[model samples]
Target: MKLFFQNKLYILAGILGLATSCEKEFFPQPPSAKVAKETTKLEASFTATPPLSLSDAYWKTADYLNIPLTDLSKNELYSDGFLNMTGTFKGLSSFNKGEDPKVMMKAAYDKTRVYIYIEWTDSDFSPEFAASIFNGPNDPLKPDTFRRWTSQGNSDKVALAFDIANASSATGTFDVVGCAASCHQNKMQTATGSVDIWNWDLALSDPLGFARDMMTDGTKGLHDDEGDNLASQNKIIQGNSRSAPIFEWDGTQQSYKRPDGKITLLDPGFYLLNKTPYIGDLDKGDKIYHDADYGCNHCHGEFGGGVGTIGEATAFASTGFAGKYSRASIKSYSASELHPGLSYWQKVPAANQDDLIAYIKGLGSIPGYYLKDPTGSSANIWSVSNVVRGRINTGSVHTNYKVILVRDLTTGNADDVQFLSPKGKSFPFGVALMDHDGKNHIGSLKHLLTFKL
Candidate 1:
């Protein structure tokens, strides 16, 4: 009996061992499936060359790229004919995340040869399609394949627009307008003649309103010059190159003294920054009005400086002066009465002059040229995001993805207002700001660059 019992126990033990081995073999987990590799990075690069000017004040540095007008010296003596800006850039990204890109301006100069660099990332990328467009009355329709150019504005405005991809990354790339190859065929040839200097692209999105407020005095409901409020009556004195005037006067009430002498205007009205010139109604062919009377030639220097019977001033005043009988209606304002060349004349085609003025009007006045400054973090910014969707087909499921609007600060704003990328990099889905809407109050001042460390 003992032997039989011991044999039974051994058999039972063997059966239990077999069961344990089967459980270990069947229930063991397989190594976790390897994770999929990340997609290759996207990248880009950009470059630019700026123009230089003769005056030192025109010699801009990165510091002025985003300066406030209030900080600008009130004295008309220290004017930089206009702000110039430039920059170098870098970026990297994945799957074209499609977020709003940011950028920074690095430098400013008056010289024409400006050097700029932009870099971004992508599996396949090219700078060939990247381009720029200056949005004024002059710019052609967007996606502007032809990139047409028109006449400049009264203030000699120039804007630089850039198209960029992979904007958030350090290797992102960009291209600017108002440069070679990208400019319009006819417009490029006549670029110097075109105006509309406001560079909305260079300004930050938030403070655009502030910039407009100060320049146009939009918030204060004020304008640059009218009656006695202007630093200089509409009269632009010889030797005065600064933008803001040094003196204010009512043409009829007081004599405008150049630091050296006092003079009276044949037309005793204040020049309006926003309104049309007093002689707007004058016909295009009327030889009576010359450019100097409007003070355009004072800074520009008569087209070729060729000697002429009527100086720019005499020519301009001629329309008002014409026949001697109507003296009281239009005073006897003569180049001799004030100073000979003070009212010098230079002749240009009326069509060309009108075109030039038309361009200038599009750019608006000096302060009005740039986009307004930032208002607040929430007010002047935007965000973008990436998302995915699932689709099922033929007993299988596939995943799809897309970029979506995460946030938009530009809503409810006019076309002129929008947020700029942090460093001036382009955002594929980013907002396009008007001359009055952006981060830094001032837009890209032609050759200026606001660099950040």
Candidate 2:
């Protein structure tokens, strides 16, 4: 249900304060090793038309609260094996160690949608997600792929969790432990309840203008709520022990059409719209370059860079070249065209060129996940991240992400949380902000969203 869970939770009332809020007055509670305590409340003041963008006037009408946060670095207690990797959180950039990022939040509601806005400072602008790096034949993602997913380069993320029932687990109440009530040893679940999760994945769902709507119950634990499958891994299993990407860009039309009839410009280095499945002979491609007699790595190293160009190594995930798509784009129609100046450029066979294309396009790094038009109940939350797509801030100051999320007030799904008026004006919730980490986050807890009745 939750992509990443932190022992620390922050509740900034966009008055959708943590994606939900409480009244503005906050009473500090004793801090624990993980969670920072806050008694926060905010009003989801009514709006005629719920705003979905940060520029909407709804922001002008409501007051945002400054919430406290705890540096829950490696929340390993109930992480289900997911842990924040120290020193690598910022990917290729230097982490701003002493800057106490000021976290702010606010919210609003209309007849159909509930909205929340949260923003914070980050030292680095990490927009790349997990990329399929060519780690020879021993990459862990080579399927049987169970757990321990880390982004060689990463992006910023925010999430909100709300209770769907009178819930309890691990001897804690939803009102008390917040998300911990449902998080367990190896899975995210409530001992006796369910939760509605609004996960804003920067690289995954944001491109589709959505916050993945998900849920977790006492039984099945966490899962994507039924509907159109929006995004999934771009990998395919080639028998066992070996795996490769299933799709790649075939053309240069920026706005490629989706199977569902929606057309959107695919983010370069982040998405693949034109699709061509792997139909070439890998054996032919391998022998032409990596073969002992041919040896592409002799000059370009294992995958791309070697003696003269170690700084440009294609196989390793580094700062500017983290994800498969990071700094990788489609052009010129030929792999040899990518490096025409190199020796033996024309020596490669056209019939086996795809293997080189796959090696260069697929190997230099590729999207860890692919986007599709979502369907069904899964499309509940519509989101807009106020950031320029496909561009990273290399300037002196890091950018602060202003993310806006909107969802139906009462999604009639059994697994989702409902916030009907009158009896349901105030709902307690938890929310988190990850700089570059998936598991560990800085967040606020105990914020209640009170709809202005």
Candidate 3:
């Protein structure tokens, strides 16, 4: 069955571009926000012959196995290996509801690395705004700003989660239910234990570079457990930092406001924070940081009344002093408040750089820090490329991406799960895709990966 899929991919590679007309209707669409009652399982066996290169030619190799991801809820699974994984993704927030976008995926791997390919249908190719480009919907001249909680102004993203020890032994619900088990009103906050996350964001982590290495330990707190804090908060600051007064729609005019004179609108869009200065006296108050409610706590979790560390203090202040009503005025501040000297809010502090570098080096002795460029360096173990030809749906403009990640089977890093030996070991994993618009995502299905000679 796997060989059939591999052969089909190669055979269709040539005519795949020409078959777009019929490809749109090739897969069945699942209903919106429909959860699967039964668990979906996918298995991948090891192959001695891996792809010779991480390029189009290598992907055509017969050694690479193929699997079709169809509507799991509808039981549309097939064994022919055709690339037919397509379905709509439901919106996570109430503001954007009933949105169901479709996506497809393929995967392969070698002894030292794993490869994944994903393609989703989207009408727009939204990239994260350049530092100079304004991202706010309200003002064209203003600097770019966007919400931290949502992907409104940012680039598209894809994430994969691995359950290290296996579902039965997992400390959290991730092994049994996948990501949905961790998601809650507080943004995927779980009770205990951690899940390894490989998140690829076009803007935050360039395609060719490393995916944002992150982990979420279903902790109840906001500060420690949240994934991708920098990107999320940057969006929040931009979404709230608007030139004109923010307004909300009352199903009529976009002029609704809270009794305390705060903007009631949920999706304020993106704006550049550094471009917008504090209008009032710094000591007295700033409307953008103080008066507005940017919903930073939705993802940041909670940091009690300014912790001792600079990062903790920033998180505390930016989250309106742990969601207190009195601190609502501080919500308008820019992302700079989170990292004073950094051009980007997410940049790691210079003091912490060495520790981070040492940590990455410890991870399989990879040689360089995860943030460093791999080109012309001994740390060039990962190879990534955007797969453009496999896009099938003409109804929308979309993109496909492939990532080749190499690492030692065993990495001594405490946070990292060591593959050790693959002969009898099985690793459980899941995937999520964020569409081009940055509005919706399809996530939370589990797969078991094994390597065999």
Candidate 4:
């Protein structure tokens, strides 16, 4: 009887162990599985409605269609239906590692227009003001008097990128990673594909014009040359050279002078020659022209005489008069009101006199043109029509921006991506914001956008 009782105890222990093993094998769970489930649960859809108008009244209605955009950092969703997205930017080229402030976004659309409203906190507002042309003797070392280039000293801006072609069908990558898939270095070249970019530069196209419509494809190709290199190649294209000096009227001298207090001269370039002429007080006395404070001769003159090649002469004429005796003639003519028998000014044909006058007249009146072509080109694979407005609350350190962008469902351009499809179709997009100082901006991350009528 003792042996039989021991056998029964052993059998019961074996049975218990087997049951525990089965439970462990069948009910295995991993942390990654839990995360996947949470992500799937939050992959929600958004709907867009037509607004009565594309004004402030229409944006007010967005309060009703609020959808929560989860803040990936905190793993929390804002209670209100605002997509509160955050990121940090780091790249040796543009920025250092810095936290991007929270950005809230809401969007609405009409039959002809799409309106997106964004609000964020900013402490300063930097507009594209005129650069200080007055470079005195102490200008180079004086930090206060130094001026940054427009490209370097610009206003805040925002950009929106859209994957309209759904080109990720093959890789199934953009569907998952969105804009990041296309943003890699050397990955966005024309050979790869193109993405639509709607860039809103505050100083360039704030109240009157539309966003700069741009497209990113491969880095190699003719478009890149036209967009990047051709501007400085001394190529005499229609829009190749577009800078003119800023001049002010000198009431005492009864003439127009540059901000640096020198007589302004005509720019013989294409754009300036066609424009109107400066019509300030005519100098009955003498016209004193000063060499450009910053010019090619200032740097290159050490090797050769102060003279530059004809191309350089054309390019840097605004820096100073260009010719063998151009500098001396400019000064002597200003004092005597007579040409100094110089080959450069004497070569001006009678037929071109009106153009010279027109060029001079437009001086100080025409504003600087920084954008190559604000209207965009079909070759660039992008186009946009937009209206934007903004209000800044200094005390709150926040600025609200409203943008209305209009485009066709299908632009019918080969470079452009077609968005005319079923209502449930989805696309990937991203937004970047620059603060008032224009120093910092959000970088990385793309959001999902679904179409609903």
Candidate 5:
């Protein structure tokens, strides 16, 4: 009887163990993702010859370190920009986990430059900047009702932070923090430390082929690196305490054919770049849009473009994807831009053309910024992404981002960090990922980088 009872007990214990293992494998916990094996130190080995191209076959041989990114939307300064979709957007803490919250980083250095490569997944392709579609005419009593931005805002971004002085750790005292040290309350501003920031903005800087080089010092927010700039805000404040984009494509569509035969657009990028300054009267556009006799109200309904589906139609009542019909279905065009494959422009009467365009410009998806190539210290870090160069998978629901950032091994900029000689034997840094957000991000701290000699 004793032997039989002992065997019975063992059987029960085995069943319980199997259940626990199954639960552990299936029902995983949050704040951590199942990713590739992580390496301790990120090593940058010296290479005598290296191709600097983003899609080079030579990069396949480099060793990489995988880093996990966790939820960072709980900071005091973490904001969801004009659209507050925290815990709902596609990332770490979001209910709908879209992207795998992991980054694979690789490093290599030549005689003159250091190259850093990173790859991560993002579900959405948010290339458009801020547009101004749903704004109403200057209303004195309700100025806030018709603000500039809407849900169709936010851009994708990634940033790296390094110690400027002996400030490798976040606080310059304790080595626990990484880039989080720079972020004091809102943006990164330490009480006694400074950091050199390399921000790669998909919308603002990528189109111009550079990461924005910036610096932060004791309690001071982010500022530009001396010499050149990557971009500037193309905003203009109007009478009702609201702002609008100061520029637009002068009804012209310009494009650039890449070496890969990808035709990248250079005009009306949703943001202005080499486009004409905006010259429109919102009141005039609004009047022509609602004119019963000659208005598009017959087909597009009361407000925007589609029949009550678009934002500008109901003054932005309808939501995302530009109200079913989409801008692609009905977009402005020029004879010069017309190709054998398509046509989205209609020849409207010259009298109504300007007014209709003015109203269209008032809608939200307009660009609140503009771009220019960088120079000086700011241009030190040459950057590229798969999205900008038309190197990404066009058919995927959400594509991955493979970015390459290369900079001089020793740029003698007063505001920049130097990685000279044995001093760079070991370096600590931080990285942040922003998914359609300006402030809130998911990142890790205190990642050590070592030189492989």
Candidate 6:
């Protein structure tokens, strides 16, 4: 979907695909948080697949929407759209035969677009239909600052800043774009995607695009129906090549209309364009570093498979659902004895993940560090997992993937460092406090090498 914030357009369309499948490696697995923290360890199991069609009426609870409603329970909020759909898959008793529902939602802000997809096994779900979330009486997404919307029946138009990939010091800022969702129940109606071809003429410091004129009024809303939409931009289509445009970093002198109809342009730091060497290339080192990597089947277990509008869909209806994958869950790995809890990382923060993010973003390429995967290397997956972990910890936990330093603080030299998994399994690894050139840097974890299995 695309939106015209202030007169500048933002394109938000991204591929909704499965994550990189993993190989069963000798890599040590971590134990669950419950087992180590003395909390009750729960066991869970469930089935998931795409719903047969638009009217499969998935009755189970699923919360793909990230916004928490003030009045409704989690389940109630999830099922709200389901409650609105009137049809059901007539002959299908169950979606057990591998059919999954594919739900995709795409939204854009000023310069970026965000797409989320999920697959489940119910007919009640609607890709369209943006309702007011619990926080805002008439807005579908609340704590409404991060997002805005325009609706057309089963389809609710949206403009959102999917902040998941902001890697700079202005990490909170969003790459804005536009998108639309049609009612999934009504398969008869087709929902297409679009992009805004305008430049960022506002500030990038605020996440909501509030300081900019594009979002001040609802005029930033662009559509496929709009004759001169950015969707026609050949450069945008050739830039990213997956699902959306890869805008260029704002450095050139470009002027755009503000929401109030004023003319303005932004500085170099305001926007980033994807002018990588591999333009129009899909399945490159960068394609996997996207939000749509988690498709419907990959998330909500036992539900239909569909791209989500935003956020991850409910893999398990109950908290128990996650219990089934306890070994793979974040809580399991972060609190495990082998990985050392949050406290341990705080005592000696080795790696500066923020610096790492800067380093990665500095490369101006997706999957910047681990560029290729010819050996089907786990490095890119590992980097993504590590980066995600660092974001969650907000600079607390450190591990082999995120380790910054393993050298003696006194000597500040390369040293034999030891690493542990969540299960307390020892792994052979080396750490050092070094600078960009691998020279010793004061109080930082710089060099890391691993040979452990």
Number of the predicted model whose lDDT against the real structure is largest: 5
How close is every model to the real structure, measured as TM-score?
0.21, 0.73, 0.44, 0.45, 0.73, 0.18
Query: Taking the tens digit of each residue's C-alpha lDDT, what string does model 1 give over 1-453?
Result: 999998887677657757776543434567775342321111111224331211222223222112111110111111222121101011111111322222222222111222222111111111000011112222221122221211111211112332211111121222223222112231211122121112212111111111111111112221221112111122223222222221211122222221112232111111212222322222331222334455344533232122343433332211111211121222333223554543332334444444433222222221212111124222222111111101101123212211111122123333222324323432221111111111112222123232221
Task: Write the residue-wise lDDT of candidate 6 on 367-450 in tens digits.
Answer: 101011111110100000011210121123222211010111111111111112212121111111111111111111111111
Residue-wise C-alpha lDDT for candidate 4, range 1-453, written one tens digit per residue: 999998887677667757777533433556442221212111222334443233444444343222223221211221111111111112212211233344555554445434445544433433331211111111221133232111112345666677644433233445565555455432432335566666665544442234555566545321321222101111112232222333222112112231112332322211111222222221210021112332223322312233443322222222111211222233355235352223344444434433433232232122222222322242232212222222222234333444444444565565444566635665667665654323234544466555554
Candidate 5 global lDDT: 0.60
> Which 10-residue span in candidate 4 carries the lowest summed lDDT?
78-87
Candidate 4 lDDT score relative to the true structure: 0.35
How many angstroms is residue 180 displaced in model 2 relative to the true structure, after the best TM-score fit?
A: 2.1
Better model by lDDT: candidate 2 vs candidate 3: 2
For candidate 5, lDDT tens digit of each residue in 24-47? 444345766324334677777787
Candidate 1 wrong stretches, greater than 4 Å: 1-150, 153-281, 289-306, 309-336, 341-453
Q: For model 3, how does the per-residue alpha-carbon lDDT over 331-400 read when each residue is reduced to its tens digit?
A: 2232346534233223434343333222211111110001122222122223353522111122354434
Say which prediction, candidate 5 or candidate 6, comes out ahead on TM-score. Answer: 5
Q: How many clashing pairs per prediction, in order?
A: 103, 31, 31, 14, 16, 72
Model 2: lowest-lDDT 10 consecutive positions: 76-85
State residue 316's C-alpha deviation in candidate 1, in Å.
8.0
Q: What's the lDDT for all of these models?
A: 0.22, 0.59, 0.36, 0.35, 0.60, 0.19
Q: Rank the candidates by lDDT, best first.
A: 5, 2, 3, 4, 1, 6
